[model samples]
Structure formats: structure tokens, C-alpha cells
Target: LSDRLSRRVGMIVPGLAGMAVMAAVLGAAGWLPDGAALVTLVAAWVLLAIPDGLHRSSASALVVEQSPAPSERGRFMGALGACGALASVLAPVTYGFTAQAAGIGCTFLLSAVSLVLALGCVSRVREASSPATPE
Candidate 1:
């Protein structure tokens, strides 16, 4: 998708937002009654993978194209990788605690919140770094 277009942010944002929406739906499904819950969970699970894939691919492509100057790309990738590794190490514990303390549904809701916040951070960084255009 990124190869076919120039707007990496456009694709990345919607992909993540779609992921968040489906995650919220899945979370809400956990709170629904039996048959409805089963149906929703099935549907959401089926839909979830698409946006997850889209976000992963587009975001990675964007990182490559939008990261700092050429000299800093390696450092940037290293930092990004370190952050991802940290998240990998911490996420299971966070999810387990959150699940134990506040039902599994809450974990998805928490992830939705986190995704939104992360998108906001990305947007702010992109905006701050982008060169201003003349009116």
C-alpha cells in the first residue's frame, strides 16, 4: 500500500484507528450476552487481523521514509527496536495484571486508549518536524 501511494500518515492513521475500533468492539463483546457475545467476538476476531496487518506494514514503511536524516537512520531504527523490545517485555505483565484486576475486556479498552495516545504522539512529532509552508 505504501508503495502505491505517498501518504503514509494517511494510511497509518486509519489502519490504527480501525484496529482500535475493532479492539473496542471486541472488548464490548466480552460484556455482551451469550449468543451476541459469541457472534461479535467471531466477527471482530475475523476483522482484527486486516487492520493489524495494515498498521504494521504502513507504519514500518512510514518509519523508513519519514525517519530523521540518513546518518541518523540506524540510531533511529535502534531506538525504535529498543522501544519495541521494551514493550514486548512489559506488555504481557501489564496485560496479565490488567486482566486479573479488571476483566479481559478492559485490556482491549486499555489497548485502544494506548493506540490513540500513541497516534497522537506520532502526529505531534510529525507536525513539529515537518517544514512550514508559506501561506
Candidate 2:
């Protein structure tokens, strides 16, 4: 689980980096109004989702490239699919609550903090050694 988490942290950074930049740009430009804010929020979601779409395409290419033994490939893909499903179920709920409590701008800030924390762990093993162990 720790290894998987570490691997996912790597995957998340690129997308989150882009999100942070976008959020900063939008906030600096004073782009948030009720309707425009909602539109921007949806656009952010679509942008973030690009990584997932890329991952699926990459995974498909991997299966084709590796040409794994029949059963193993199916099992590998199935586990990957299950992990993705779990993320899909949990992420929106978590983000929705955070947005409700802190507002979307703060949510973006929180996400940036999380990304920085994740990257710091890579650079400082002490941080990586401790499990996140969500409360």
C-alpha cells in the first residue's frame, strides 16, 4: 500500500502542478463570479481529468507492448480499474466537503499544499517513512 501510494503521489504531481498554476492565474485575474466560477470549476475538473484519460491510454499501450500472459494481463488491468473506481468514489466527496468548508480557492490551496508535501517526501526520506494514515 505504501509503495502504491508513493507511485500515485508521483502521478498526481504533474496534474496538480498544472492545477495550481491555473488556479493562481484565475485568482490573479479576478475571474471568479457566480456563473464564471462554476464554469471555471468545471473546466478545472476537465483539465484534471486529462491525466486520467492519458493514464488509460498509457495502460492500454502497456498491455499491448508487454503482451502479457492472458490471465495476468486481465488481472492487472482489473486491479488498476478497481483502484481507479475507488479514487472516483472518494475524491469528489473529499473535495466537495473541503470546498464547502473552505471555499474552492482554499481547496486549490490545500491541493497545492498536498502536492508540495508529497514532493517533499521524496526529497526527505523522513517524511516518506511516516504513513499518511488519514484521520
Number of the predicted model whose TM-score against the real structure is largest: 1
RMSD versus native structure for model 1: 5.0
- The prediction achieving the highest lDDT against the true structure is 1
- What is candidate 1's lDDT per residue for 7-104, written digit by digit as tens? 33666677778888998998898889999999999999899888778777766655655655666666767777888899999999999999999999
Candidate 2 lDDT over 10-96, as tens digits, reads: 443344455555554434323466787777766766675665443345444343333345446667777767977998898688879
lDDT of each: 0.75, 0.52
Badly placed stretches (over 4 Å) of model 2 are: 1-52, 63-68, 109-135
Tell me each candidate's RMSD, in Å, in order. 5.0, 10.3
Residue 41 shift from truth in candidate 2, angstroms: 5.6
Candidate 2: pairs in clash = none
Clashes of 2: 0
